[model samples]
Target: MNPFRTQRPARRGGRLLALAAATVAALAPALTAGQAAAAGPAPVPALDVTSYLGTWNQLAAVPAPFNLECARDTQANYTLDPQGNVAVFNRCTTWDGGSNEIRGTARIIDQVSKAQLRVEFPNVPFQEDPAGTPNYIVTALGPDYSWAVVTDPSRLSGFVLSRTPALDDASWDQVRGAIEAAGQSPCVYLTSPTTGGIDTIAPLCTR
Candidate 1:
């Protein structure tokens, strides 16, 4: 069953209303909230993966409920881990003020193009089961492939990844424009909180 459809009736007040709205919204085919009225930025049709293979810093992103438990400095790294699979290194600060880290593998499930691919964590065998929808789309990539945006077709997911935590304001704007073109409402992006972590990241997320 779709997780969005499983709603409890006990909740009341604003929470219930918001859940109802989310369920209705999820069932619809339109892009997630904030996609309409976007203009100017032209959509880039394909991504370049060859140059895309490298470490990318997570700048700002929509806070998905699944990742909510992650610390403000949460970041993911991709490398050709041993065993010939795309290894994923996910690290974050824990709520109890500890470090959170997990290792997983990724593969190109759809093989749409050399540029586009779906990445899955927890390894391939675990993903083969029916309960697997935690996939991400490689939407837009920089010319040098130093930065990229990952979002699903439903527009329910968005991530701004870079080769470094700090990106120039002008280049960031260009990426934001491209995201808008991909039908994502730019208003949902929230800056990653970076304070007293391994990497002191300045809040680079913007509207």
Candidate 2:
């Protein structure tokens, strides 16, 4: 045998090392994902609440019992209220070819980011969100407030909003990307069938 040649014990040690390396390689992805989860999703920096207040089209949203009547053509119009809160007017087409709407108020909770707010709808029989949970977090937004990804602290309910009823391919991709960045699966967001640009009511991931 050569002077530097290893015996059976050395071969065993080498095999163990190789096995450990393979194990780590297999777990690397999971570890990285865990790190991201630990960090948690956050809102964009210094959002201009004034510029953000306007009409936003509902591109896609997580299915919620409160929105069961909304078959298609969803939109939200926001304006400033004298009490320093935002007034919310959400409208959507019902299956019976009539329009339904609900009015609410959004009070900004996080003064710094200006992306966290609490919305309260008065006299609405539908109540999906838990009581006293005061966060309607805007997790993602585009430049000039072209598009937005809305989610709550729990990351369960979500909404993909746009400035118009329809969006281009790049804008659609950006919306989906924001959803993924917020640690939400696009499959949970079903597209809202508007006038154009992916009018089919299907899961966002299918498109």
**Estimated TM-score per prediction?**
0.65, 0.77
Quick one: best TM-score, which candidate?
Answer: 2
Clashes of each: 1, 0
Question: Candidate 2 deviates by what RMSD?
Answer: 18.5
- Model 2 clash pairs are none
Tell me the lDDT of candidate 1: 0.54
lDDT of 1 by residue, 1-207 (tens): 000111223232134235334543553444433344443222236544445666666676654444444445667767775554467777765444556566666655444454334455452242463543436667677757767777764565677877766667687887787676677655555455454322422222323
Q: In candidate 1, how many Å is residue 88 off?
A: 1.2
Q: Which number leads on lDDT?
A: 2
- Which window of 10 residues has the lowest lDDT sum in candidate 2? 1-10
lDDT of 2 by residue, 89-168 (tens): 88877666667777888888788898887887776543456554545788888778898999876665788888988878
- Residue 191 in candidate 1, Cα distance off native in Å: 1.4
